[model samples]
Target: MILLVVQTLNGFQLGMLLFLVAAGLTLVFGVMNFVNLAHGVQYMLGAYLGVTFAQMAGGFWAGLVLASLSAGLFGLALEWLIFRHLYGRSDLDQVLATFGVILTLNEGVRLIWGSAPLELAMPRLLSGSFALMEGLRYPVYRVAIAGLGLAVALLLAAGVHRTRAGMLIRAGASNRDMVSALGVDINRLFRLVFGIGAMLAGFAGVLAAPLISVEPGMGENVLILAFVVIVIGGIGSIRGAFAAAIIVGLVDTVGRGAITGLAHLMLTGPAAAKVGPALASMLIYLVMAAVLALRPAGLFPARA
Candidate 1:
């Protein structure tokens, strides 16, 4: 019972993190009608930047703010230097170009930070564990991460649902051509969306740094997961992203334990141990497939 409770909390933490990364990616996809395969690298860069800036400023908060802003600016720069030209290009071209950017950035990260994984220092205030039950304890930092992520999610929801800019974002997502015809300066909107998305991805990275090893190509797997998130959530839908992200996180985390236990009931311990994880890893993809089969637009598809 205790293990289940702890893992559920862990699942929520994971879901929040996934929400942060997927939020930005979905926004960019929804508004720009562009494919950005390089988006995950922003998350990777955020972790690296957080580590560097935290050491330089001698504090975690300072590092988080600076890294997020830097990530946003970096994204804008990429938009101007490379992505702007590719906006009207074919999706294949965009994918190829962004894939190249991934290779270049990964190599650059290696050259600058080296290939070894780096760890971020947990903030002093969140450095201890708190009892969740009579015998179970949980890390304060993990709780903080989930709390912060949820706060961001709420703010993002409000911004998208209530703000004028958010209205434009939704409008753009629904029909960029129509939005442009209405004198919306679609390019500027695209830039804003892209920058914000990058910042959000970076923010996720900063939060995840202390919990995971910061390494080269770390974003690749995350990028794949983010894509899964957007697909299952529904492209161009923030609400979908949020709901799907949480569902994915909980399913993935809890399924691992449940599958293993079930396997133990039917197979040898060692075989169960081995097979459990393999099946667990497929749970999210299986869920995604199931969702797609039933509702091709996802659980909460964007309004067209």
Candidate 2:
């Protein structure tokens, strides 16, 4: 029971980070109709920046601010230099161009950071575990991370549903042509949307830096996972993203542990050990496949 509780909490933590990253992805895709394979690079940039700034500032707090700012600026610059130009192009063009950006950025990072994994130490204030129940103790940092994610979700929900900019964003998503015909400065909206997406991805990267190895290609796998999240949640639906992220997180974390144990029981130890983890890894993808098979439009596709 204690083990289950702990794994559940860990899954939520991972899901929260996924939400942070997927929120941007879904929004960008829903509104712009553009596919950005380079979105993962923002996460990478954030982690790298966090490492660099942390070393300079001697702490995580200041480093977070500096890294987030840098990532946002970089995102905006990329928008100006490349993404904006590709908006009217085919999805294939966007994909290829963004893939190029990914290659350039990855190589650039390797050159700058020397292809070595970097890590940030958790802040002193968040570096321990707390009693969750009579027999369970949970890591303080993980809970804090979960709290931060919930706070961001609330803020994002409020921004999307209650603000004027959000209304414009929704309008753009529902019908870009109609919004543009209404004389909305759709270009400005696109830039803001893209910048926000980049910032969120960067923020997620920085948050994750203390928890995982910061290295080249770290974001690539995560990027694929985030796409799975958005797809399952319903592309362009923040609510869907939140719900699906939690689901994916739990299924992924728990499936790995529980499925392996079950396999060990049902098969020879050696075979189980080899195949169990492999199944666990595929578990989420299987879920994604099931979700798509059932609902091609996703669970909460942009309210349309």
Candidate 3:
């Protein structure tokens, strides 16, 4: 019971992280009608930036803010240098170009930071555990990560649903030609959306850095997960991203624990242990496939 509870929390925390990354990816996809295979690298860069800022400023909060800004600026720079040109290009071209960017960023990080995974220490203020119940305790930093992620989700929801800027974003995504016809500078909107997306991805990276090994190519797996999340949540829908991210996180985390336990019931220790993780990895994809089969537009698509 205790193990289940803890794993559930862990999974939820992971889901929040996934939300951060997926939010940006989905927005960019919906609004720009552009495929950015290099999006994962933005997350990677955020982790690296967090590491640099944390050490330089000698604090976690400083690091978080600086890392996010750096990541946003870096993304903006990419938008100007490469993505801007690819806006009207073919999907194949965008994919190829972004993929090239990914390759470049990956190698650049290796050259700059080396291939070893960087370690980030949790902020001193949050480096302890707190009681979740009478006897159950959870890491404070993990709780903080979830809290921060949720706060971001709420802010995003508010902005998208209530703000003029978000309205424009939605309008641009749903009907770019119409928005453009109305005198909206579609390019500027694209830039803002891309920058925000980059910042969100980076924010996720910064938060996860202390929890996971800070390394190159780390974004690749999470990027795939983010894609699954957006697909399940519905592209261009922040609400859907939030819901799907949490669902994916809980499902992935709990499935691993449940599968391992179940395998032990049917097989010997070694075989159960070996097969448990494999099945767990496939669980989310299975769910995604089922969701797609039933609703090709996702559970909450932003557009028809």
Candidate 4:
């Protein structure tokens, strides 16, 4: 039972991280109609930069701030140089250009950081564990991650609902031509959105750095999951992202942990071992397939 609880928390922490990455990807797709495969590279950049900054600044917070700022600035520059040219192009063009960016960034990181994985030390304040129940102690850092995810969700909701820029963003998502017709600077808006999206991805990377090894291609696997989150949540809907992230997180985590246990009861140990991870990995996609078959649009699509 305690093991179940710990796994549940771990799943939620992972989901929150996915939400951060998906939020940016969905937003960029929702508003700009651009398919950016390179967004994952921003996450890789964040993890890399965070480790470097932490080593230089000798603190977690300072490293996080620097990492996020650097990633955002990089996004802005990319937007100005590459994304700007592709905005008016077709989806295929956007995909190709972004793919190029990914190759360039991945190689750049390899050249600068080498092929070795970088390690990040968790902050001293969050390095300990707290008693959750009898004989159960959970890492404080996981709890901190969950808290940060919730905070980000609230801020995103408020931004979209109450803030002027969010209003513009929503409007743009629905009808870019109409929004542009209203004399809004769509280019500038895209730049801001891209920058924010990059920062969010970077923040997720930084948070995950200490938990996971920072290495080249670290973002690729997560990026695939983030896309699943976006698809389940609905491409343009923040609320949908939040709900889907939690659901996917719980399902994936719980399924991975429990499948083998359940399989062992029915099958032999070797069989269970072989089948468990495979089945667990497919669970979320199965959920996605079901959702697609039923709704087609998504669970919570942005208001039209």
Candidate that would win on TM-score: 1
Q: For residues 80-151, could you state the per-residue lDDT of candidate 1 as single tens digits? A: 999999989899999999999999998999999999999899999999998988877789999998999899
Clashing residue pairs in candidate 2, if any? none
Query: Which stretch of 10 consecutive residues in model 4 shows the poorest summed lDDT?
Result: 295-304
TM-score of each: 0.96, 0.95, 0.95, 0.95
When 1 and 3 are scored with TM-score, the better candidate is 1
lDDT of 2 by residue, 1-304 (tens): 7788888999999999999999989999989988999999999999999989989999988888899888988999999999999999999999999999999999999999988798898888899988877867777988888999999999999999999999999889889999999999999998898898898889889999998999988889889989999999987888899999999999999888999999999998689998898899999999999999999888887858
Give the distance in Å from residue 113's predicted Cα in candidate 3 to where it truly belongs: 1.4
Give lDDT: candidate 2, residue 154. Answer: 94
How many residue pairs clash in each candidate at the backbone level? 0, 0, 0, 0
lDDT, residue 25, candidate 1: 90
**Which 10 successive residues of model 2 have the least lDDT summed?**
130-139
Candidate 2 — what's its lDDT? 0.91
Which is better, 1 or 4, measured by TM-score?
A: 1
**Model 4 quality (TM-score):** 0.95
Candidate 4: which stretches are off by over 4 Å? 132-136
lDDT for each residue of candidate 4 in 186-263, tens digit (9 for 90 to 100): 888888899999999999999999999998888889888988998899888888889889988988898887887777
